[model samples]
Target: MAGRIPHPTLKGPSVVKEIVIGMALGLVAGGFWKMYNWNEQRNVRAFYDMLEKGETSVFAEEKDRGPD
Candidate 1:
């Protein structure tokens, strides 16, 4: 075994590749978060618009109330 040559060691993924993957994942997550917030805001705005138009009520009727 003294005359035998040594084999080269294998390397893991490069730092640049890892960084790019992380950035892509972050972007996807951020996009989803933004979309969710936008949808929530839109729903809230629609509810408020309906309220302004007197299309809905937030309180129960007098007959539906239980105590004084």
Candidate 2:
């Protein structure tokens, strides 16, 4: 019986490709998470702003925005 060994990389550009992919994905994910957190903080601040405006109604904000 005979066995063959596999080459880890075909002497190719694996390292450069891996680094580029890692950096690209990191930037995309980081930017997305940053925007998501910013949006959430703005929303919470707006909620408290409305509450301070004496706009607190028995109904939901979205629903209460309509006429009584």
Best by TM-score: 1
**Regions more than 4 Å wrong, model 1:** 1-10, 60-68
Cα deviation of 14, candidate 2, in Å: 1.6
lDDT of each: 0.92, 0.87
For model 1, how does the per-residue alpha-carbon lDDT over 4-63 read when each residue is reduced to its tens digit?
899888698899999999999999999999999999999999999998999987886567
Q: Backbone collision count in every prediction?
A: 0, 0
Backbone clashes in model 1, listed as residue pairs: none
For candidate 2, what is the TM-score? 0.62
Q: How far is candidate 1 from the true structure (C-alpha RMSD, Å)?
A: 4.3
The digit string of per-residue lDDT tens for model 2 on 1-68 reads 87998868777668989999999999999999999999999998888888889876547655555766
Worst 10 residues of 1 by lDDT: 59-68
Q: Say which candidate scores most in lDDT.
A: 1
- C-alpha TM-scores of all predictions: 0.71, 0.62
* Model 2 misplaced regions, further than 4 Å: 1-13, 57-68
**lDDT value, candidate 2, whole model:** 0.87
